[model samples]
Target: MSTLGQRFSRWMQSRTLTGLTPGPHDITIRKDLRVPMDDGVDLLADLITPIGETDPRLPTIVIRGPYGRRGPVAGEARALAREGFPVLFQSCRGTWGSGGVFTPQVDEQRDGLATHRWVREQPWFTGSVATFGPSYMGYTQWAVAADPELAPDALCLLVTMPDFGAITWDNGAFALRNALGWTQMMDRMIRRDMLPLGLAMIRPDPKLGRAFGVLPLSDGDTAATGRAVHWYQDWVGHERLTDEYWTQQSHTASVPSVTAPVNMITGWYDIFLPWQLRNHAQLAAAGRAPRLTIGAWGHTSRGMGGVAVGEAVAFLKEQFAGVPSGRTALVRAYRTGEEEWHDLPAWPPPGVAAEAWNLHADGRLSTEPTAGGVTAYVYDPADPTPAVGGPSLLPNSGPVDNAAHESRADVTVFRGEVLTEPVTVAGEPVARIQFRSSQPSADVFVRICDVHPDGRSMTVCDGIRRVVSDDGFDEVTVSLWPTFHRFDAGHRISVQVSSGAHPRYARNPGSGSPAFDAVTLHRAEQEISHDEFRPSFLDLPVWAG
Candidate 1:
């Protein structure tokens, strides 16, 4: 280690985790230890270990990510270490005290393997290894698992995407809100060391209203970051989902090859919920089955890990001791509206079937197709429909009431009669619309809500489809985020149809003009036509068994 590294390690050893005490064991904090890489660079890591355990070599767990290695996870690491297990908390190759340039989603395999190798070399390390963390940390665990030579014995992952494109190009529209919010935070993290306190103290969410409103999205990165975030700009520059840029950065390509058992934890309204849920099916298709639990929460549900850590430890202990965990089911999903957890044998719960509730012309949804007409609205780019609540990373994002946005003229809502009995929807919801747009291009934003007896409609989930084909008409399928919800007696179900969701998805200017750059704003005349001949409806996943 360099003199600076040595001094930093000494300083780290003396430091206590802010607002948290050390664990119950005679714990030792060895910080800033350098793990050597193949190319002669060393990455920084900290170890929390028990001082006087009977075993000289102990089973281990690792958490690696770009964020500060010791800030949020240190307490968790200490606690795990006190349970007679070694915990390794390491910064990714580039970030914090590590010795590499910071890049996202592209460099975890080599560094992850190096850290695992470093751990095995320690006198206190056992042969068995496991990995656990959330978000980017969870991603790092997956990235590392891609390597057969370095796969951990078990995994505990939370709230992460299978591929980067899911967040970059969600359901065919640019994920403007998520990209902007995340990159802005990263910009601050990168600059804090070099900037003076006066200059460094950027607000956590600095003027996102103005930043995301910038046109020609190429400039949006500079507007949000004060300087160009190359990755953000790269995402903006490559707007197509079919672009090779997204495919090259995808981690899903290597996901199926991983053989270790995985424990996945996620939120119902998490920003990555769509992609994370997709991963479960993907894994099953690839002959790998992972344990899962989805909760009723949003993106920043880190505290959920506490209850889950015990489960992780139990799983790891079983794996480390050559015992298989006799888990029967594949999923444990939380029912949101009812606020209850349901242990299931499979996703979509065995016999759940789709029930098409037909969209009608008289501003009502019914089981029978009895009406024929069109509900039309003019979508103005200048006054686009605002995104209220759904699966987003923004403030106040989740299952909030949608009454405020429902009143907008550009938004058309179709209501259903009050249900005499309870209706439980347990999986993905699909909206198949037989529609037309006056302009050459447009967007269809669809949302499902549960209307209380008193008429308060709370959003369940939403989706958007950008249509470029204006061939007189088209049928667009908008897949809403999956949910475990129940509409009780006297409550009604409704669908909110609109042309845009504003910054959550980049608004369609309705002109077929170049992506998000065109200033030519066309007032799109939107129409939803449903009749006996042409029926538009919502295919809700009604639980059958």
Candidate 2:
């Protein structure tokens, strides 16, 4: 390696990837080796190995994803190779220089299994193997981990889940921005439009907002990219989780059966946190010891990537080289408001008690239930309530001040008194709204925020639920994302009730029609009752510890 390159690597380890020990070996990258699959189509992969290691003793690390094998992924491969592990970084089908047509999640299973088999058949096969990557690459790892015969020796998954269908239709509402934004991103990547892609990642395209506003989501793909994206359209068409298309696309059924040593890393603001935690829980329930680490970051946070790589290297070394993992606990999570890291035995640790905070008509939130009263708002599909900040694929993701959004007329705000003592929340926050809509179909978007003394209301966690109820009033439960936050003394806990979080979740047309084909917009008069008979409240997972 050149002196400059070596210096950069040392800087990255000491600063960005802190706590990880830099390796001594220099690396060589063997490019464009073809591995044949079940259908006789060859997938191109690059192998990175230590320069002096002709016979590699450590387990080979495999990374497969739709993203090209160069750039950040290649850097990770080289880092692993320098650590004395041979790394096979392969492009997914039809991506980069690979052969077969790309179909996202549908092809990962067969392709991953075939690649693992091919690795074992190679002359330099090390018998043991591991898979590592973040996001889509993590899904690729889960794709083959279910099969005991084909599963890798270890898996390092970051901010990803097995079921794409769940994220597509989270809380029974379409994840419009994330789903569509991801489609546009992959479209640009497949075309090798690096400049625009890089620009979009840094800041969302302003023109893309107009495309997202287009009626009938089937046209959204073309409007955003000037071409029809097959996967986006397919996702829109199969909005229901029970649909056969989504069933074929999901690999969640594989989680409990995975026998590999697993290390999962995610952020509280990450798109896949909830589902990934569920996967960890499933593995734990099945007697598998999967390690989980969560940070206070968004999907696109630079810190998230750095933490993932550092943790993954430690996990790989522990599994393959008999090295100490150096992990403090089975579950390590960073508490946001407190700004402290906690090592726990498990997620939501024991003794978390649920506290009900009642919502009053005069925008007051208290523990005491109010008498009969209701608050109403008008939600127009033509001018949907815009999303401020939360889990999203765009650059402006994670916790942002939501004061402006709360000031909007379409959203109802409920504020609690300034806290005299600190209140820590450690699990999922759920909202139960005794809701009624003028239209048969409507959506209820609920959010939890921490109001600082300076008047900044930063979003903590939120969720949306689409409802179609014929009953006069339905108690709709919206389960917000799990969070670990401390509302310090003098800070207030607030909640926002709205009909839509616009581009984050697709707007409900209020005409009892699917968002995919609904072009007719109807204004919805939504009501939330705080009546004793139909009490609406926010259930907080209050951690007394």
Candidate 3:
């Protein structure tokens, strides 16, 4: 084992089980089992079995991931094992205690199929299996499900989206600023040494190292250190949105071939919300049994405490109980002061209607139709509007606060009159815009919020559109992620339109140059239209919920 893995194992042994407490019945834990792949690479796995002398074979849940297989999914595996399901937590071919160099999702497809095949041949195999996890783990489940020979009985995907190009590398852009930090952390593991790399790269303080269990980067010539640098450079070199490189790497192209029943779980505040919705839509449209559940939480919130573990357990039970009926059971829960879970036959709800709110000349949003007039705003890239609230990388709870950001002069705030009745928007919020820019390119950011009577405004849904691809007088439709928000009586609906939402999304330099080295900024004269010919308006999915 690598030094870091050895240390982590010792720590787990000490913390997970103390002196002689009886372990759970119907579950036996075994670590460091080798499973050979088709490519002759032996992958390491930790198996959790439901002990039964007569029926050693039990329904299985396979969680194949790049993150330490023994780490993130440990809690879920233990919980599932206790529920009478054998959970196999396997490290990806080249991650953690596994043998090989980590190369992200490229190896996952073959390794996942091999792992499933190996699991079926085991003495404890029950001929029934399901794949589940979040993010990369979730993507692996989909990839394995796409394999014709290894189609699992069910797939429970959490917070993973379809199309790497659209979401993961949106138009060939990395969403998370912590990508570098994550790469560095993984590099340390690959080199078999846990050098306090992320902390050193971010803050470079030795004192902070103690808190994070990180050792100084100078401590050892860890393989992870070198891997991190290489990964960062590789990511930087690829700049085109639709290059042959990205086309071959994308896994969504295989979605049409997947036959396993899919259960997608996402969060409203997740950075990949839009992509998750698209995945659900595609799967459902392809005549597959697909279900979707979205909550008002971040990437790690559902596992931590925001949502109840029982909810996920119930979902799994439902999927494994019977064959999917080619029907979608859509549910959306919002953390609106308290948790509210609502069920619908379809996304956006069948009875729900689209309400168009137009931007008036006097900075007012209303249902009234306007004449041939336009609302204009000056976009200055030097002092762009700072990002506040929305689905960002920062570790926090509840909805994000964008009130302070609204005060900026550069941010154009358009507000509709307070609603006399409560209104709920439950689906994808779209902004149909007809605008002309003075420069060759510009970025348009739209934020939807519910303004309370007390003057507090909480963000609901937001979207961004890079106008560089658009012609001067072309109309564009920007679709914001779906949201569930209750606009109380006397509370108004507002849209904060601006040029940029920095950091959350890399600032569009407006130079019509490459994403990496393009630093030149151009001023633009933007004109927003709301009329019959160029009927630009915000389409809010008004739901009864």
Instruction: Please provide TM-scores, in order, for all candidate models, with all chains considered together.
Output: 0.89, 0.96, 0.83
Q: What are the runs in model 2 whose C-alpha is more than 4 Å off? A: 1-21, 53-57
Q: How far is 205's C-alpha from truth in model 2 (Å)?
A: 1.6
| Model 3 Cα lDDT, one tens digit per residue, 176-242 | 2334345555666676565574455445434322212212222211223432254444454465546
Residue 529 of model 1 has an lDDT of: 79
lDDT by residue (1-545, candidate 1, tens digit) is: 44575345434433532223333355677899888887787888888776565343336889897767656566566656755678889887767768877778767767788888778788867777888887888888877786767788888887886577767776767778888877876767766533532242343345666887787777787887677888887787776867887776677877777788888888888887877877877777787878888888687644454545555655666656644656556788888778898889878788798898998888888888757888889999878888886676643466778887799899899999999988889888999998898898888889999999876899988888888766565788999888889888899999999988878877777777766466667787888877577688999999864
Q: What clash pairs does model 2 have?
A: none
Rank by lDDT (best first): 2, 1, 3
RMSD of each: 4.8, 1.9, 6.5
Model 1, global lDDT? 0.76
Candidate 1: pairs in clash: none
Error of 3 at 189 (Å): 4.3
Error of 1 at 458 (Å): 0.6
Whole-structure CA lDDT of model 3 = 0.66
Which sections of candidate 3 miss by over 4 Å? 1-26, 52-58, 171-178, 188-231, 239-241, 302-312, 315-332, 335-339, 469-471, 521-532
Better of 2 and 3 by lDDT: 2
lDDT of 2 by residue, 1-545 (tens): 67687667666655644455667777766899998989989999998877665334478889998888867666667777777788899999999999978888999999999999999988767778989988899999988888868889899998899988999998788999988888888898889899988888677687587888988989999988999888888898886899998898688887888888999998999899888888888999999969999998777676665667778877877777768878878999999999999999988877799999999999999898788788999999899999887897654577899988788999999999999999999988899999999998999999999999999999999988999966588899999999999999999999999999889888999888776788999898999998986789999999987
- Candidate number of the best lDDT: 2
